[model samples]
Target chain A: MQSENLISPGFADPVFQSQAAFRALLTALSEPGLIQQVAPGFAAPEGLEPATAIALLTLADYETPIWLPAALRDGPAGAWLRFHCGAALVEEPAQASFAVIDGAAEAPLLADFNPGTDQFPDRSTTVLVQCAGLAGGDIVTLSGPGIAGSRDIAPIGLRPGFWAEFSANAELYPLGVDLILSQGEAVLGLPRSTQIVEVR
Target chain B: MTIHQSIPGEDTKPAYNYAYLDEQTKRMIRRALLKAVAVPGYQVPFGSREMPLARGWGTGGIQITAAIIGPDDKLKVIDQGADDTTNAVSIRRFFERTADATTTEMTEDATIIQTRHRIPEAPLTSGQIMVYQVPQPEPLRKLEPRELETRKMHAWAEYGLMQVKLYENIARFGEVTTTYDYPVSVNGRYVMAPSPIPKFDNPKMHMSPSLQLFGAGREKRIYAVPPHTSVRSLDFEDHPFRIQSWAEPCGLCGAKDSYLDEVVTDDQGGRMFVCSDSHYCETRREQGHRGTMLADASASGLVEAKS
Candidate 1:
């Protein structure tokens, strides 16, 4: 890890900033497909987006194992994460409590990560993926506990079969990866319990 | 990002960290909270911290409020549906001093409500969050004393023992005798204890717009039911789950729908039922919904003035 990469400060007032960011994260997860803005002024390395960086800083700690994809692993993003959050960096995706996917196109299958067990389903992974935009891609309809009736989202940059993979992930019920899709300052959550269907 | 050295009125009590719990502890709990929301009804273990209050005195709910609340949130605390009770008032004041957040007794005015043993009669909206103080997070604790075995049972979705216990209740009494702390299935997946709220309030948890979070301090567990989640109280098909009802309306508020607490006025078995939610009762009274007790008091006062 390079020393210059660690120059970026964490939260200036760690207590308040992290608290606000965490609350935003909680609201995003609780209301699936709801896009939220977090830590507006916090800057990250070249590869990492602001929403992704804020999510990591708010949720990850020493107990959490963060897995970085090849691009982030070799870049300044890894060092910035290590310097700010102090979370363990895992080489394998299956062992990660949190995983960062730089781009939605390069994202791995949902099954590649831990789905946790029936009793301890919360042991699964939470993946943060950078997307091109929160809106203007293939329209996805989400219906689940968080949604009152149904919600329509158009997330860009995902590959062709992303919804199929996500549907398969949803079939796991209580055990599956929770996703946070980020683009610049905006982020949207897609918990495993949500049923996603791509509109024709 | 300027940090304050001391807030005004710091001399009243010992200086505490923002929201009482430190940043590291808050982060740990926040991670667990996300997982808890992801897997609705599943208990996620975390490092439960010691608070100024004792374990059974709502330490779990306090830690949760401290973790999620900021300076902008308006908080409400309730004990047995009353905001003026000692436990509720103390917890409300604690947050006011530590988090520097606004406090309210009105249900509709609050963004976050930390409750012990009851949900408010008023319906919760989409943006509100409810934190429940749970003495025991596990619904299967009475059936299985060992934590390891209970965890395995939850993992396997083996709720046969719980069903059997309910069956035994049916055998002893004609219907399910258990009233408070009724067990419910969240999203049809995991069996959860809806805190200690009366079964009358159990249905309110079903498909609620507001997010619901449960915390058990001694048990070191946190669980959640996100907005619009399904929560069904466990019961048989033949005998459906039912809420408690009183033959008489509230003596102070004239409300027939609210949960009532019977108050003894005289030793000769004379008693009056009043609304347990003091705020609700007061609001109704202000709206000119007078109960029998209020009517009687006014009548007596009029006679005294005439005399």
Candidate 2:
């Protein structure tokens, strides 16, 4: 195995950049929707990409069960996550609080997972969706709990079908999964409560 | 100055637990807890430090229990309020090793209760503090991404966005459909996340005598609501805050008012409503509140009941 194949590998060595990524995730979640640059580490598996690795490093713990895409389930990614984060592999999406949907086109139906109950929306699963490109481009009107006014930044190569599935998810409101779209080294947040309206 | 060394080889006891989080971490958690008691339904952010346990686990609750625990204190931990649940058992075991605190399944006997999902069925007294393990601390983060912007919104008391979201829910669902973790406005100040406890537990926060503390170790934030403080669930007058209700009482203890967990009994889809708080239900049964069939079963000596 390559030296970089480890999820966090030696990044937990208390280096400047690894601490920076950890702090970035902490701040992003604390503030919400706020983008913080993370110096990416770990060699991502074929379909399960670099951004997914970043998220796996930041959030995965022994207590959290990770739901993997079928293709990546028994692959190097599974071994890497287990060895590095000690995360359990969950068979069902609903049982997993954190899910890695590599090649999200093949990802399972979002409704099948826990969107959380009405009073406890945070219990809903947070999915890390891997995409081919994830750069901010065109504007999409976004209004919900987090937006002061509508704002837009297009994540790259995310299928229009993804948006449709997400909007269907929005119909559930307090009971919808939150999303993390990652392309290459970039990641963007799409909490379930966010209302995304296509401008174009 | 002469360099000092141990006179002979001896096993040294580490001052703090594995993560350098000492009893003082629990003490600091306890102090925050007391302040939360003094004010009700308020999000009082504390300087939450990292724990050896992972962030999502009951780090916040553990810290609080550690701080408030003395030699005499009895602790209880529940995930979904079941004492025997795996996570609950693990948390109780953690305290037994670290703090050496006596553990209890009963809510009445517990000085500190750390919970996820459900609060205890029995109402807690002023003497107890409930520590909630929070995954996210910012209520406005869902509204605004920038901390700088959200802080301003909070300072200005701008909760119009939250209201708009709820209004939309009503508009869409024809009902205010939020069933659990409904957002709440605390002390007429901050719109706070009540740590994902069901809406059934929301009303329990209103001017309650017991203190409530929320901790998010992963998020590195702490907030509190002291006893006797005002906590209003975020809802319009037209769409008032409501708790989940069921026509039936608990299967085990005949508890009428307690939050119930729906269990699927058969493959054909028979469901049963059991008390979410096993300890509270057991206590109630001991005090004699048996369901129609249950009381008869007990009377007939068909089943033995344990409190």
- TM-score on alpha carbons, each prediction: 0.95, 0.54
lDDT of 2: 0.66
Pairs in steric clash, model 1:
A119-B155
Q: What TM-score does chain A reach in every model?
A: 0.94, 0.81
Candidate 1 structure quality by residue, lDDT tens digits, A1-200: 86664557777777888888888888888999998888677787878888888889888888899998877877788877888888888988999999987545545777889888876788899989787899998788998878888999988888667788789999998889998899988888899999875564
Please compute DockQ, using alpha carbons, for every candidate against the native two-chain complex: 0.72, 0.01
Query: Which ten-residue region of model 2 chain A has the weakest summed lDDT?
Result: A10-19
- Stretches > 4 Å off in candidate 2: A1-200, B1-20, B23-47, B292-307
Provide fnat values for all models in the order shown.
0.85, 0.00
Where is model 1 more than 4 Å wrong at Cα?
A1-6, B1-14, B295-307
Task: Sort candidate 2 into its docking category.
Answer: incorrect
Model 1, span B1-307: residue lDDT tens: 3333356756665667888888788888898899999889999998999888789999988999989998778999999999999999999988877778899999999999999999999989989999999999999999999999999988888999999999999999888888999999998889999999999999999999999999999889999999999999999999889999999999988999999999999999999999988889999998989898876545666655333
* lDDT values for all models: 0.88, 0.66
Q: Is the docking of candidate 1 incorrect, acceptable, medium or high quality?
A: medium
